[model samples]
Target: MTTVAARKALWKIPEAMELLSISRTVIYEQIRAGRLRTVKCGRTRLVPDGAIAEYVALLEREAGR
Candidate 1:
């Protein structure tokens, strides 16, 4: 049987930055501005895949306006 690669449900801050092609400061700024959503697990922050998608959609909507 062939197997497909599994997608990540959660991403770390650095990973999200890389995925979004943004800098660390910008990522944190987005989170602080409520443009991006993140969850705190212990001392680590995690971004859900859905949040990233939502952020992109938000940008697209803004661009379309």
Candidate 2:
């Protein structure tokens, strides 16, 4: 049997933007506002997959309230 590659644990800014369908400016805004969690790998910033899911859940919670 063939094995499938594992998904990425970290995503770049552009990838996160595309996944969230957000603009570069908006993504930066979220990061600045502490709404979107990200980690720094040297000079590069990366978003954890869990962070994206949490962000979505936050939005859902807000909408439910």
- Would you list the C-alpha lDDT of every candidate in the order shown? 0.97, 0.96
* Candidate 1 lDDT over residue span 24-65, tens digit each: 999999999999999989999999999999999999999999
Worst lDDT run of 10 residues, candidate 2, spans: 51-60
Model 1 misplacement above 4 A: 1-3
> What lDDT score is found at residue 52 in candidate 2?
95
**Per-residue C-alpha lDDT of model 2 across residues 31-62, encoded as one tens digit per residue:** 99999999999999999999999999988999
For candidate 2, the C-alpha RMSD (Å) to the true structure equals 1.7
